[model samples]
Target chain A: MEITIAHLYPELLNLYGDKGNIATLKWRMEQRGINVTVKEYALEDEIDFDGTDILFIGGGSEKAVRMAANRLCEIKKKFEAYADNDGVVLAVCEGFHLIGTYYKLNGEKIKCAGIIDIFAEYTPDRLIGDVLLQSSAIGSTVVGFENHCGRVEIGCYKPLGKVLYGYGNTDSAQYEGVVHQNIVGTHLHGPLLPKNPKLADYIISRALKKKYGSVTLSEIDDTLELQAHKYMADRYKNCVRKKNDDDI
Target chain B: MTKIRNSLAIVACKLLILAGRLMGKKGSSAPGSIAMKISPGVLRSLASQIKGDIIAVCGTNGKTTTNNMIDSLFSSAGKTVICNNYGANMLPGVACAFISRASITGKLNADCAALECDEASLRHIVKHVTPTKIVVTNLFRDQMDRYGEIESTAALLNEAFEKVPEAMLILNADDPLCAQFGKGRNAVYYGVSEDTGLHGEEAKDGRFCPKCGGELEYEYHHYSQLGKYKCIGCGFERPNPNYSATRVDISDGLKFVLSYKGSQHKLELNYRGFYNIYNIIASFAVYETAGGTIEEAKKVFDDYKPQLGRMETYKVGGKNVILNLAKNPAGFNQAIETVCADKKAKDILIVINDKPSDSTDISWMWDVEFEKLKSANLGRLVVSGLRKYDLGLRFKLCGFEGVVIEDISREALEGIISGNGEVCYILANYTALFETQKILKTMEDK
Candidate 1:
């Protein structure tokens, strides 16, 4: 099977090691004997989202997000159509904030692609730490790091996971990330894939299903991958539990 | 009353130092913290007594090495230099450094004070010691928890710059964000003029022009965001560097020709990597601009070795173990490139600690270009530290094949030392570097 992955605004939205997602996705796909061709779409680069089977957008600084939003607006319709067609999409951190309807920063509303039906606003204090989430989509714990000031409001979209530890969508919200169709947007940025290979495989499998109609991905040895995942998940979980115990 | 207060502060600092020594502790910060508590204005008072210029080096990376280089350059010219060589760059630690060198009457007996100031603490330090010259190495995304973004960090430095308008600014012309600091100011810009063959296709930080908000077109990149760049839309280009490394050859050791005012001087550096080349040139620029001769600066570079945990080499078990500090993405990428540049097979030990000094957030590891290691002949990949698995997973995902050891201890060091590879490269974060160095020292003694 073949898949074309288009990395959107890689230069502008490149922060917090978000490019690791691209590395993880490519490695996992190549390991599965799937042919994968990756293309990069930066500030002025022409993007053909229709031909893209999977799309990845990483995080960046606030100013970078502003710059990326201007360029991303040029291809908003194409990206929305790609998502509507069940194209696998993963947007992380500031990328997640930019995919929403609008991000409110310093009392000014910065309009984005509006690809995901959500609104994110900047908080005075940033939420920064390791995050552990019980993701229902992948049916496993997702471990990653969250560093942002945007508090997202998932209006109608399904959440990717429940916040097992750390601040997720917002300080008050119990969930983390937005999942609409095959699209996923999250603030988790341990590049969001290497530690959680299940989600990487799940996204690849979903993209393959969209192309091949009905197919089950062959499972490879996930021993080392799962061990890494479990290590992080347990560490964050114990940290949260310890905090709760101290509070009591 | 002022003498009595200064005397009390000095005594408190000395007592803390003595206690630290008795406890077998490297009390780099405690004495400073205690001195600040004893006399809040001690840093300013002591700094005011200094007879010569105070040179402050502030940036995310290379602050220590650059500060030490400036210190060595000044000292080699027969000037007595006082510096906080223990990597304590904060305000209190800086205060403690001055207090340690000051007499009981709060008199500083030093020809020059060359100090490294943390980017976040630059504002606080400037309030006390008004440096005659300030060198901003480069601004990269670092310690997101402490500094929200690179722009915010730059804003903080700009705010501090406004306070010290008289201080001469030394900047990196190649860095877009750093180059912006030179705008509307008389700044000495230093950058690599010739391409060093370090450019990569990866997404780089500071790719947009700060002036026009347009995408920057790079003539060629020398690693992340350090490149000759121009904006076609606004016609904003790299400023003409007053002090430039006209040519850099990092084939063996760093060999570069420094150009200033129609005169070029050849300099051979004992340091490795292009980043160190930038550091060396930045220090040379500061020295020359501060009335030092090029001949004196060249002599300093001839014998200049970086401080501990920064490319410090040790021989253990008949293998050369090189320790280099990789605190952030930019620094880590340079260290990785330096290792990969060698064709010989080497056992690599990557240690990552999430200590407060080492940045509690470990997400920056994902930003480093570990995939470059795949092309190198890596023998055994030993990953150690509190976040050893994270580093191991990153290497594994990057398609590097080797025996992965996740434990970081003396035993792990022994295993790496006894490995088949003749050379062992140990890349460590801020805290891990110190720990690894102490372990290596212990093993070397045995």
Candidate 2:
């Protein structure tokens, strides 16, 4: 199988080791003998997104996000077309925030790709720490870290998962992420995929299923991967239990 | 009223420090934490009583080493100086340092103080004590969860120096972020004067012009964004450093000639890693600017030994065992470069913790060039700590097999020293560093 993944703003949005997602994709596919072409599209770089099988966008600081938003405005139409064609994408943190209708910055609305109906607003209270999610799409717990200053709000769409622990969309919301067609957007970036091999495979399968009309993902030994995911998840769970017990 | 409050705060801080020591806890910051609570003016009043210059060292990396080196220069001159211990560089710790050293009469007898202040906390510290010289080592993306970005941290440091305009600023000209601070200020810049042909670090945080936000063109990088740089759009270029290290030879131990004041002085040091040269040069710049002569600095550099895991070496099983702290991506990259230089197979143990001191965010491990260590012939890979699985997964992604896992520091140390290798290298983060170091110390003692 062959997959072509296009990364947007690889330089500006290269915060929190988000590039690990692309590396994890390439690593997982190469293990299955799947050929993957990774192309980076930085600012002022022009390329048609029609043929791109999967799109990966990472998070960044507020300054980087604004720079990306300015450059991405020129390519909004091209991105909308890609989203319209049910292109597979995995966006995290501010990248996911930019996938929405608009993201608020210091009360000013900075328009994003406008592919999805979701939007995000900057919050004074940052949602940070280990996050545990019961993701319905994957039928398993998705564990990662969230260190974002903004809270996302999915407008009339099915979210990616429920917040089992830690702050999700907002401090009180149960939803952790939102899914739009083949695109998955979340704030989980403990690089998001290295520890969660299942999600890595899910994104890879989504890309293959979109391009080849069928998915054939060979299983690899995920013993260590699950161990890593459970390690953080269990720690988070115990802390939550401790907090609840203290309240009593 | 203020005098009584200050005296009470110091006496209370001293009693707590004694109590903390008796309880088997080195509570370095707790008394400072309590002192700040009792009297907010405790730091300000005590620092005012200092008889000499106070130099505040600010940077993402090398602050501890640089500040300690300055401490060495002061002691070499037989002068009393105050300093916060390693890992206690925050505002509370700065208060504790002054509180512990102050007379019960609320007066400080120290002649000088070289404080390693956290970049984010420098603004707060300056509001208390106006440093005579502000030493900015270099800025890089460290503990992003704390400051959000390097620019934000730089802005905090900028605000810090603005509060004390009379202070002579010591800046790193090689770093664009540090160099940018020199603009419209009383500042002296220090940088390396050669292109070592080495792409020092993989991650470049200072690739853009701080003034114009344009792409920066580098003539040569000493490592990770530290180099000779010129803005492509705006004509902002690297300023001529007041203190420059010419002919830096790091093939073996560090050798460099300091060029400043229209004269050159040669100095050599027994140290590993390219960044140590910057740390020492920064310390020398402060020590000299504070009134120490070149002869004094040269003497201090001759046999200067950095403690608390600045490539601290121990002999174990008749083989060399080196320990160092790798706190951030850039720091880990430099530490890895030093480790990869050895040709013989070595046991490499990496311990990672997610404490607040350790940044709690281990995502930056992906930025460290662990892949370079893959080319390094290794006898064993031992991973341990609170976030051992995260570190293990990172090394696993680098395509290494049979990673020995040990969560306990003692077991991890034993696993490495007992392995089939000619040497052992233990690299850990802030919280895990001393634990592994103490364990290795006991093992060596036995």
Candidate 3:
């Protein structure tokens, strides 16, 4: 099977090694004896979302998000059509925020693609450091880092996971990220894939199934990858548990 | 009254240092912290007592190495130099450095003070030091949690520049972000004119012109965002550098011709990589503009050993173990390029940490072009640190199939050294560098 990955705004929205997700996804598919081709869509390049199998978008600075939002607005219809057709999409960090209805920063509303039913606003303080989430969608504990001032509010969608550590969508919300069908948006970027090999495979299997029907992926040895994931998950879990104990 | 405060601060700092020594602590920042607490204006008072000019080097990277280079070059020219060579660049650490150099009477007995100032702390430090010359190395996105963004970090330096209007700015002409600082100032620009042709597939930061917000068109990229660029919309281009590296031959160990004041001097640097070339040129620019000869700078370059962990080398089990600091994408990419350029089969160890000192966000590792290393003759790939598995997964994703280890300790180093590769290149982040160095030191002692 052939997997066509469209890396959206790779130049502008590329921050904090978000490109690693693309590398992980491509490598995972290639390991399964599947042919993979990556197409980069920047500010100047025209994108045909219909031709893409899996669409990946990474995080970026505020300025880069603004620049990318301006370009993404032009192709809003194409993106909506791609999503409506059940195209696999994974957006992270600021890219995750841009997929929502709109993101409000510094009292100014920046209109996004409005593909996902979510609204995000800049919080008074940025939520940073390691994050651990018991993701229900992937049926595993997700480990990554969250560094953003925007607090997301999900509407008409389920969260990708429940926050085990670190702030999730909001300070009070127990959930993290937004998931609808094959589309997933999260603020987890340890580039969001390397340590979480199961999630990487989940996204790949979903993409493959969407194109070629129900398929069971052969298990690749995830011994080292799972060890890395458990290490981070346990560290954050213990850290938060200690903080709570001290609070009491 | 101010003299008495200065003396009291000096005595307190000396006592703190003595106490730290007795306690077996390398109280590198404590003395400065205590001295600043004893006297709020101690740094200013001590700096004012210096009989010579004060030069401050500030940037995201290369501040320590470049500051040390300026210190060594000035000292080689028969000038008494006082510097913070202990890799403490913040306000308190800088204050500690100044306090240690001052006499018991709080009088500075140095010909010049070459201090490395942190980018965020530059505004605070420049207000007191009032340096005669300020050199800014190329700015890249680093420690985003502390600095917010690259623009915010640049704003900090810009505010500092306003406080010290008399200071001559030594700017990097090739870096568009650094080039922005030279506007409406007495600036001497230094950059590479010849291309080294080491462009990577990684995304470039600061791609837009600060003046018109127009997308920059690069003639050729030497590395991440450091290249010959022009803005077609506003006609903004690289400034005519007063001190320019006219020719670069990085085939061996960085041989470049530096042109200044209608004279070109060909000097070969002992350091490797394009970033170090910029560091060497920036140091040379500061030294030359400060009334030092090219001949004297050449003597300093010939014997210039990179400060520990910037790109320090050690021999272990008769194998070359090269250690370089890879804190951010730009630095890591340069290190990977340097390693790939060598044809010999090598064992590579990448140590990544998420300590507060190392920038808790390990997301920048994704930005590094690790896929390029897949083609190299890498015998073994070892990944270790607080985020060893993250790096191991990154390498695995890059299609590097080798014995990947996660143990980041002396045992890990020993295992890698025991491998068949004749050379071992260990690239580590900020905190991991010290740990790896300590482990290497213990192994050497054995």
User: How many residue pairs collide in each prediction?
Assistant: 0, 1, 3
Lowest lDDT 10-residue stretch of candidate 2 chain B: B196-205
lDDT of 2 by residue, A128-243 (tens): 77788888888888988787878888878888788888778887787888887889999999889998888898888888888888878888877778889989878776556112
Residue B37 lDDT in model 2?
Answer: 85
Q: What TM-score is obtained for chain B in each of the predicted models?
A: 0.96, 0.97, 0.97
lDDT of 1 by residue, B57-167 (tens): 988889899999999998888888879888888887788788878777677788889999888788888998999889999887777767877877888899889999988
lDDT of each residue in B1-446, candidate 2, tens digit only: 89899999999999998998999877678788788888999899999988899989989999988988998999889999998855578888889888888898898899989899989888889989889999999998887767767777888888888899999989899999998888888888888988866576567667778877778898888777899999998988888988899887777888888888899988777888888878888888888787788888888988788777889988876878988998888999998888887778888988888886678678888888888888778888888898888777787776878887778656667767888888889898988887887777787845
DockQ of predicted model 2: 0.43
- Encode model 3's per-residue lDDT on B1-446: one tens digit a residue: 87788789899998888898899866578788778887888888888877777999988778898999999998888888879888778787788888877887878878889999888888878766879999999888787756666777888889999998999999989889999888899899988887666777564778877666678899877777778899988988888788888678766888888888999888877777878878888998998887888898888888988888876788888778889998988888888988888778888899988887788888888778888888668888888888877787777776667757677877789989888887889999998998899889877633
Residue A101 in model 2: lDDT? 78
Candidate structures ordered by lDDT, highest first? 2, 3, 1
Model 2 TM-score relative to the real fold: 0.96
Docking class of 1: acceptable
Error of 3 at A95 (Å): 0.7
